[model samples]
Target: MKLQCEVEVINRMLPTFGMRNRGKGTRAVLSVGRQEGKRGAIYLMICTLKDKAGSRYKLENNIEQLFTKFLGEGKATIRLKEPALDICLSKAEMCSLKNFVSIVGLANKGSDAGTPLLSQLIPAKTSEIEKPRAKMFITSKKDYPITKNFPYSLEQLQVSYCKLARIDMRMLCLKKLQKLDLSNNHIKKLPKTIGDLICLQELILSHNYLESFEVALCNSTLSNSLKLLDLSENKIKALPVQICNFKELISLKIDENDLLQLPFTIGRLSKLRLISAAKNKLSCLPSTFKMLRLEKVDLFGNPFIQASPMVPDIQLKIPQTLLETAAREVARYRIPYGPQLIPATLCQDLSMAKTCDCGLSCLNSFIQIVVAMNLHQVSQTVVLVDTMGGTDAPIICYFCSLTCYSHFLDKYLQSIRD
Candidate 1:
């Protein structure tokens, strides 16, 4: 049986019949060659422009019209005997023989020595043709091929802008598939069986509505082989603690989510070099995060509060050089008040005030009065006041800042006078 082979002209050009434009004459040429056994055929149609006086030609159109024309023929080559010409016709049979001869003369000046026309017209073997996989584009449109779960096989699958309601791994059993993109879909969840795809290296799940990831993804089978995982633009509130299992993960993107905190187990992902969690609602991070060996981390738009020393220290020690640098950063700024003073009303309000008319001297006096009014030291005085009040004790203001310093002092003096 003769194996049918396809020779598509991915790029082509037609020679111009008229005079040179801007001193350059347009030319087109198709080069074809084959190996011992006819495994497959390759047809390269190049459209070039050469200065009327120059010997070299410049390539103009990279996508040749020949491929489009050949696709319509359902065959790679066409042979004709009436004219005693073994002519290879592409989908664009519009190529004129006179123009082709002119292009050949311009492209191959010396090859005119003895090669026959049929030899030049034959297509080359498939090995000579470069095959570039199509880019994967995930979309949310309902009519996309990936939405219907066709049993199709491809090196790269682009399903961008598709409204995918759900994903069932069993239906997509493409064994040779390498890159799978499901971005811009409305998928709310992923099947745990996704780990079955042992050969998958790149998985893009960005711009989806996923709330949580399947725990099965962290299985050793998937984690050890997976290289890049994009889970950006999701509604995930928290990442699975098992994510640390993906020791081989080179890049993990979870940006634009509702995550409040990172799991402490994240520190175990020592191999992770890049992690992006920007645009989230994180308020605090675990101190164990100090163990990460990340090259870059994106934590922008997350309300992060510095952790206190009371938090558990990371088991792994940061290099002394880094610690010294961090210490220098801390030494740059010093808070005047102790941590205990943070809850004081005067401290809270005055620290936040942009401008306070009260001069430095007045502020110093207020601070002194507050320091002197330690209510915890006068338990007996508090009990006597409570007993005299009978049914209910009068609310007493204890702190003596600028707001209450004069009133407390006047009341004490009036009691003595009475």
Candidate 2:
């Protein structure tokens, strides 16, 4: 009888199981019957119970089962108020309605969904329900001492945005912590015992007032596990040479700092891929920097001077020889009160001069006479002249008799031409 009833219920629910109009309270029943001479009837219902009392009782029993299996023998309440049978399952003399719906579409014709349902139905094993891990937060007010005694057993800790004046992290005993974030804080220094976090993988100390890096971080164990480290926006001028000891470090950011130079040990970071040292006071790079297997480098705002022993072609094209020769000639013959004379060694030309003489006779006679004769030589009576064929040739002078003769020749030539 129970088998017949289960078959009938399954058939009824099968056609409408996947249908939209089957309604929420529709039940899918599975019943088993005695093969020979069994007396009692058994029925199994698998669906939501509309009766509040019956639904409550089933929920409470399931909760009890869950606690006993997962929480190590715990007690639970069981009571139900209403019943508008949705899905039913029957086996021998047992019958129960299941409220939870499996998202995977029901397969009445096969046993594909049964294994998954049974697995989920079995409560978690006792060994699986371990104590929950704790969490840590930085809630200290500004200017307060950052206490190290955290309240929770944390696997990860985030202490950002806490305006802490001083950090005493030595008191922290977080052995299980795997990650720590101290970004955007007012931390000036890290405790020397920071290496205590043997299990830590990622540590972020960006945007802080750290004037120097923690020396304790040089520990080989910590460096091996530390994969990412960010120390950007700080007052750090130089990184410790031990930084290259981080054999496992992949990414490092030290941007917006006062770094003047990087240690050559940077080449030891064989696994380093990304590095940022922008906005620094770096004037030159280390030769070992070529050893870096970098994809990109930001070297802006650095003073670079490209120098070579050989003069450039552009400088060779300039008329430097002519300029030097003219400068030298002018310097050798210091002509005063006429075409303001420039020294030969000077690279530029002179334009004007300030006369010291005040009298008109001094200006007209002396200045004019000097200007007309091009008398560059200063002597007692007669000015000397360079009568040499070439402009740069030696200077020479003739007596007053020769000067009169030169005047006679100039007059004779002019008369003949007219």
- Model 2, residue 215: distance off in Å is 3.2
Error of 2 at 309 (Å): 8.5
Candidate 1 residue lDDT tens string, 1-418: 0112222221112224443324221222344322224323212233222211112111122112222233334323322222222223332223343334333333233333323332322332332222322343444464555445543335567676767768746335765466788888789988876787776777888999999988888874678778788999999998877787887787788889999877656767777777777687876554235456666666556654442322322222233344333333333343355338544754533332211112111111222211112212211122221223321111111221333445545666687699
Per-residue C-alpha lDDT of model 2 across residues 1-418, encoded as one tens digit per residue = 1111111111234445564333322222222211123222111222222311111112211211111121111111111122322332222111221222211112222224333332212122222222334565664555333453453347787777876545545324776677787888888887766777777777778888988886668764678688778888888988886787788887788878788777646767888766666676665444334446754444444333332212211212133356434433444465342434445423223221111122111011111111011112211222112223111111111112223334534665687699
> Which 10-residue window of candidate 2 scores lowest in summed lDDT?
360-369
Instruction: Name the candidate that leads on lDDT.
Output: 1
Runs in model 1 deviating more than 4 A are: 1-143, 146-153, 168-171, 310-418
lDDT of 2 at 98: 23
- Largest TM-score belongs to which candidate? 1
Location of the lowest summed lDDT over 10 successive residues in candidate 1: 355-364
Please report, in order, the local distance difference test score of every candidate based on alpha carbons: 0.48, 0.44
